[model samples]
Target: MQDAGFVWNAEELDAFIESPRKHVRGTNMSYPGERRPEKRAAIIEYLTQLSTAD
Candidate 1:
């Protein structure tokens, strides 16, 4: 999370997954975010698991 410069929560992760560029203007990351809700939810779930497993 050091790279993000902030603590990520559920809503923040959802928004970020929807659009990285829109979330953080002028970010170098060019990766277009997930268009499918299921996929995005999965990714967020996985990330959450990582955070909690620590």
Candidate 2:
């Protein structure tokens, strides 16, 4: 992803989370993607919690 010029920040993460393959062509991720806005938000929120947990 670094080679693709992806900074992997929140905005980029959000886009990637929405559509992995579309956002990063050639991605190995097989997740069709979360079509629901609330689900996506929950996923991001959960990931945020995981990152901040200590």
Best of the candidates, TM-score: 2
TM-score of each: 0.77, 0.79
| Candidate 1 per-residue C-alpha lDDT over 1-54 given as tens digits, one digit per residue, 9 for 90 to 100 | 236666678877887888988876777777899888898899999988988894
RMSD of each: 2.7, 1.4
| Cα error, candidate 1, residue 45 (Å) | 0.4
- The TM-score between candidate 2 and the true structure equals 0.79
Q: List candidate 1 segments past 4 Å from native.
A: 1-7
Q: How high is the lDDT of residue 8 in model 1?
A: 78
- CA lDDT, candidate 2, residue 23: 94
Model 1 — which ten-residue stretch has the worst lDDT?
1-10
lDDT of candidate 2 vs native? Answer: 0.81
Give the poorly placed runs of model 2, Cα more than 4 Å off.
none
